[model samples]
Target: MSTTPVEEFEVIIVGAGIAGCAAAKAFGTDGRKVLLLERDLSEPDRIVGELLQPGGINSLKSLGLEDCVEGIDGIPCYGYGVIRKGETVEIPYPIDPETEEQAVGKSFHHGRFIQNLRKAATHTENVTVRELTVNSLLREDDSDKVVGVSAQSKTNEYFRFYAPLTIVCDGLFSKFRKEFTTKTPDVRSNFVGFIIKDLELPLPNRGHVVLAQPSPILMYQISAHDTRVLVDVPGKLPSVSTGDLKAYLEETVGPELPESIRVKFIEALQTERLRSMPNGFLPPSANQSVGMILVGDAMNMRHPLTGGGMTVAFNDIVLLREFLSPENVPSFTDYETIAQQMNSFHWKRKNYCTAINVLAMALYRLFAANHDADLEVLQRGCFSYFQKGGDCVDGPVGLLSGLIQRPIVLIYHFFAVAFHAMYIEAKINGWSGAHLSFIMFFTVLYTACVTILPYLWSEAKY
Candidate 1:
């Protein structure tokens, strides 16, 4: 009987997206043979993953993949410009205290950025990328330990690949997440996207967030000539095939945009095909299964409102490489030590992940107020707090950018905004009636607690 031999490697990584490619490269650079698998190797055209925060840039550079963002017509983002009812506020990234240099982020076509990452992974020392569709995890009969994977090539040829450790980074709609955890993603809303051409933005080189009716709208230059606009549509969406989506954009969203962007938005609405993605929230869980672990969107995801997805993913890979380095564990065969390291990796990553996760969900709720009284008040307060400048703007923007990882910093500034909102309310209405003023104070404070506490609690869980 003739039998084909199954290929074996030190590590098998499923899904060659941002996290998978980075993991393969990092492990390969450390002298580990890695097999990176993806169903499609062609450039991925996506609405999200187009923007990378400054913290992600730092992590990417640390991984020695800094050149991936180059030669892609990627735009340099300095900060953000937020508009509410035609009023605008510019919030730039905080200056580095030690280096005396401004932090910079990049925005580009999602597919192009991803292709660059795939190229970097392919050129790495011991990494091999193949277009194979992973069918299922290979597990030992007597135990839950995942040994490798079974996959099919384009020609429908079946092959078995084996490794001591396997990483699942199949991304947002992962087929393998249930094998590791019971948690599922909570879909809060959806983002309808449009590509506007030759649009002159109010703030050049800065991401723009417009507080439009119903929800918030995001606009930023992905390339020299093209602008990406993502309109946040809460709950159920209008039917696209029936022209209801077009009517909603034209009748509701179009007029709310700033005058400069409104004209081009209309033009793009007519010419460009509409695209939408669900905004989901999934808290990160510790790796419990032996011989395998989940990473990237498969393991955790947050609302894309703040553009922190890539930042969290790259930073996670940086920590992962350190925890699983040769000097740390030496080999993946030692399942006990690998399990302990994975537990430590979970808690240690909270420093960066917690802030990004909590902030994204919390801010999205506030920004997409949808006529809710408390959130609307908080939204105005957030904008007004930015208008004050200094620590107010610097602190929040820093947390949002992933530069500042401390959850305490985020807590302090969040409450500060709440109190500031109360102050604004008092100023406008006056303290003429003591009873009414007292009642209003606690109401806003209560709203603040309810808005953020649940998300914080979600992060605290395993």
Candidate 2:
């Protein structure tokens, strides 16, 4: 009987998605031998992860992978245009205080950007990307420490690859996250996607968010000729196989869109095959496993409403590179040092992650009010707050765009929106009855706390 030999590497990254590719390149650039494994190396056709916020762009540049966003027909996104009822307000990203230039984000075909990242990783000095499916993590015989992975090639040949450190980047449907953490993703909604060709948007070079009934609808150009539309559908989705989804979009969502966009939306529905992805909320937990760590969607997730997933992922890579640098830890074999660093990495990352996570979930709840009177009032207040335009617009949009990392700022603005909503409500009621106004104030405040507190607590624990 012939035995298959075990191939060894300094680092083995499972899943060549955004986090895996970036991690491989970072470690390889640091002079470590890296083995990057993926099930497929072809361009991916994903609806999400196409939008890169300004902070994500900065992180990519920091990692010297800025070239990945180039030559991909990527569009520059300045900010967002929000529409409520018939009123529209444009919110542009705040200018950088240091550079004095407005921060710009990029929107491209998710697959194209990913392929570019893969190419960058492949070209790195010590990184070797292989097309393989990782079946499971290989553990030490007498311990729970992961030493490597068991994977299979396209031809069905099984092989064991060894490494001192194994990084799991298998993404949203990660099969390995269960081995390290007890948390599961809470999927409350799904995004139904469509591509409209040569569509003219109300606001060019910026994302347009329509606060439509049931939930929010997003439209942004991915290339010169194509615009991507994602409609948020909460709870159980209608049967797509039976045309219910199509009917729902046409009869329900289409009318809520602007006249300029509604025509193209209907056209796309008639011509394109609709694709949908679930919007999940998964809070980050510290890594307790010794030999392996989780990154990207596998480690954490947020609602896709803010387009902050890639921003969080790239920023995580930046911090991971720093925490695991040769200067920080001379060798990967130092499990004790690595464990301590992992704990620090978990908490330190919350500086940015917490804001994005809490905002995404909280905004989704407010935007998709679902006939909740309190949420509806808060939603109106939120739009009105944006209309105030100054610190109001800059602060909230800054958090959404990934340029701001202050959770305190987020908390303040959230409650401000609540109070503003209360004021608006009181005005509508004529402010004539003092008793009614006082009762409504506490009601709105309680609703605001209920909306954001749980998400904040989630970030605080574990």
Candidate RMSDs in Å, in order, are: 1.4, 1.1
- What value does the lDDT take at residue 434 in candidate 2? 68
Relative to the true structure, candidate 1 reaches a TM of 0.98
lDDT of 2 by residue, 1-462 (tens): 222589999999999999999999999999999999999999999998989999999999999999999999999999999999989999999999999999899999999999999999999999999998899999999999999999887788888999999999999999999998999999999999989999988889999889999899999999999999999999899899999999999999999998988888998999998999999999998999989999999989999999999999999999999999999988999999999999999989999999999999999989998778889999999999999999999999999988999999999999999999988887887664766567878889998999999999999986
Q: Worst 10-residue stretch by lDDT in candidate 2?
A: 429-438
Q: Which model scores highest in lDDT?
A: 2
Clashes of each: 0, 0
Which ranges in model 2 have alpha carbons more than 4 Å from their true place? 1-3
lDDT of each: 0.92, 0.93
